[model samples]
Target: SLIVKAISRLGPVARTGGVRGPHGVRSEGAFLSPLLALLLLLLLNWLHPHPKALKCYKTDSEASNLTLEGCSPDKISCVLHFRIDKSTGARHRGLSNCWNLNDKCGIADCLYTPHSRIEDHGSCCCRTDGCNLMENLRLVTSPPTATTMPSKGGSSQGNRNSTSKSSSNDSGSEGGLFAKGGSDQAASVLLFSLAPVLAICVTVVLGFFLYTRHRERRKSRSESVGLASYPVDNHPFPVGHLSSHIRLKERLATGKFGCVYIGEDAETDQRVAVKVFPPQERGSWLVEQELYSLPEMSHPNILCFIGADQCGQGPDLRLWLVTEYHPLGSAHDYLAGHTVSWIQLLDLAESLSRGLAFLHESSSEKPAIAHRDIKSRNVLIRSDLSCCIADLGLAKKFFQGESIGDVHPQVGTRRYMSPEVLEGAMSFYKDSFLRVDVYSLGLVLWEMLTRCTDAYGAEGVPAYRLPFEAETGSSNPSLSQMQAAVVIERRRPEFPAECQSHQGLSYLRETICCCWDHVPEARLTAACVAERCKALRRLPVSVAAEEARRRQQEEQLADQQAPAVDLQLPQAAVINEASAAASAEELRPLREAEDAV
Candidate 1:
């Protein structure tokens, strides 16, 4: 203060010294020396100005990307977009609406980065072009005294104020730039995280599509094969060509393999039977074709194969098998002729034995042949009344010397199945034919002996009663005194008046019963049965008795078919003949009941 005063007073003296001479200059030097030193100290103080820290605390209105365009001509309008420290919500408003909104200045384009330091307030002001706006805009509490801030050079002070603000802003900008970069980095990280999952999802979808297409192709191929719904003629094979030049006459029968039509060849005009298989059932037909080609099928009792028709791409086509056509049908149909004589039954059994023996034994060129599914349906008759074995579809030809017991465990018709087969004890692949087919032959003999009596046809008859039912009754007896008519059950057959004199039928009865033993080893072999029948032929049996039975049976059947003419009744003669047949039919039910037990 003293130095400034001294200098102020020296101003007058310095002007006088220039007017007066070197003597006035020497007097003013004493007073100016202290002032000169003080002036030097003050100049250094100005060089290092006291640090002015102006904390521009941001209000809600100062943090937006605002512009001056929205302001009225008299006021500056600007917005602030920011959040307060520890506040739950953000603040946005026009800065122009603030108290003491400085008319000389405005702020524009200000924004805070997300997650910024809310403690540090920031603001910017845009000045009108001609106006010295925002100059001395500090939050000053008190106006400085004349000595505290020199009144001279007012614009220089304004310049000093602006320089301080510019420095502060430059420091704040470094933090804002860092915050902006961090926000961008977070977004990029999120995108990278999902890339692998999306790639895996796309790969899985493509793989499933390709797999489904492959399965569709395979299913289409299978549909062309053996679907049950397809018709016989609609098969992929050419039917017209397969049946070309074949002339059908009468229908023999319809079967699972298809229709069997009796026909004649157009070229040779020879009578033949055409067995056709339904398209979907071609598997059985294919098996038959292989059986026909077997080398051991030369037996006279077996049906002969003439030719075969194979048409289509795979083994699953319709088959038309050609063979010699006979006027007579299956044994079941032939046996429908009222009654079969014991002599006729013995002859049928002998023919069957010959055929079965040929199949069971091995020859030099071929192996043991098994007709696995032997049944009454497969036995055919000719016009000459000779029996033939047909339908060899289930036949299996094994190597010579191979045992039938070692074959697959289960196969063949259920009724004729041996006890070993029922128990699954026999393996055709392990045991010889004598152990397997011989047992079946016994059952076949039993069937021929019993025939299909009406009593048994009703579904619940024991097999043992069949023999006693065949007896001719010569007397009427009480029911309570009767025993099992078939003595094969280890029970005695009660004597009937009609059958008490059947002494000549004892050998044939013994032969049929021996074949039906429970144990396979105990059963008679087909060969043994055939030999016994041959022996029986040598016995001196009256032909007149057999002829009489046959004639009587035919007349009974004719009477049942249509009404008889009115004439004198031959009651006694008719009664004598019918007594035996009536007992046989009636005993069939009792025999079946015992077998079930």
Candidate 2:
């Protein structure tokens, strides 16, 4: 029970501020009352109908045998009577109300019968309440017939009378219906004839615009290529001949695309890492160069880009990207040999986060970039123990309103791939790509923590192991193996229990967990991780201790400056008189000394 009480004190306690029994149900009614009232209010609102105003009968022919009584808040004035077929007496009646006055067409002319094959179709709309009633609709249903003639001479007279009557009927029934139809036909013919020409013109203009844009882009690419292909003499560093000017000392590492060598620039006597890419890997070399050459790409946390040059031709061609040589080499190499202290671990995490944050930042000069392949190997540690991010071959730039280019699905290292990337369900947005980098960063952080000697405490540092080495037992696990372990099984690199015992490491563990959340959106941004790392580096434990000590000192000084009181005084009056006399005597001496002077 004591242990339980002690553990319970670690977390927050919610204050209900009400009565509670042994089972905590005595105040149930208090909790339920407000909830019940809210539900009742919602139910009452749902049951109430909208207020009725001007009511009208509405029906559509398509929805047969269905009639709706619609009421508008705005007083309805117009009623429309439409007859689709006069012979069959098939009709639909509707009330036009200004429920939405902005969408309403005011005049009756706006509601007209469309030209149909049936000649008896007509509409008579009027602006009066209930004007579309059945009684008012009897005006045009039946017309008087022509009278018959008695004899052969009378037949001609009857024919003339019938013709006059028909003409009058036609005038009453919508004037010049055939003439209006003829005009409509003429307009439609003109539109049809010109539509093809307009479409062709638009298509031609669009094609021309796209073609010109493509040509301009191609020309720019060609110009850039021409500039890049210029002789080594044109370059700032001017490695006249790669073999003659640069002495390759030792092969540091080999990657899928290239091999890195610790080389000395013969002319300047400067140590540099020369990344030599074969002819087949020239594309990656070019991409790296382009990224490095971008404006505002320079940062302390980012590996310095010196220069790049191509030597030889055909199969013998070798592309060389020279960068500043760090004596400490990669974080992976450093960690493999030596276990870092907690401070060194924090520094490594912070520096790495800063580099990633810098790369992911967007400005007017450059678009944000994602270091798709962020791992221990890609992070280089300087002599000062601070790290810089390198190997940007798989890096991608994201501009506003533009999608990230479709990369080969399996471009990044299998171990560092995020859940979304592993499942091939990644959204090609800037944030999604950045989040992938963050997930990899989390794995790298785990790697740093595992390599910290202090993390294991008295048990001593654990043997260096790559992420998920326990599960897969291989440093280079296959894609399927990683998917099974990381995605299907949902296994993360084991955080040592000893590390979690420490406050700083515990906070860092939480950060790592948040960064590598299976849900990509739930992961923290690189900038956020960087800020957390920076905060961690500030050493909250020490800061808090210092603050407490300062506060204690302040309280002590305040106590010392406070006037003492004699609780054992014979009387309150005597104490007050003594204090007064003491104050007066102190003041009198100062006054006398001033007077003497």
TM-score of each: 0.43, 0.55
Off by over 4 Å in 1: 1-242, 248-250, 279-283, 311-316, 401-408, 429-436, 450-504, 543-597
* Residue 209, candidate 1: alpha-carbon lDDT: 57
lDDT by residue (1-597, candidate 1, tens digit) is 433332343345433332334665445354445444444333433443322222232323333433323232222222232223346443323232211122212333232222233232323233332121123122223332111111122364563454344423444432121111223223223323433553455456546755876888866754443322222322222333536767777888986568898877677777778897767766566566656656656677787666667444455565677666767777756655434455666577778877777766776875767777666667787665557788877677777565443346456654444556655665446233355666566555555655523112224233333222333231322222122222223332232222223432444456555665556567676667777665545431443254345446546654753334233145535755665465454445534543442
Cα deviation of 350 in candidate 2 (Å)?
0.4
Worst 10 residues of 1 by lDDT: 144-153
Task: Give the Å shift of residue 581 in candidate 2.
Answer: 48
lDDT tens readout by residue for model 2, 209-267: 66887999986774356324533322336543555578888999999889999989688
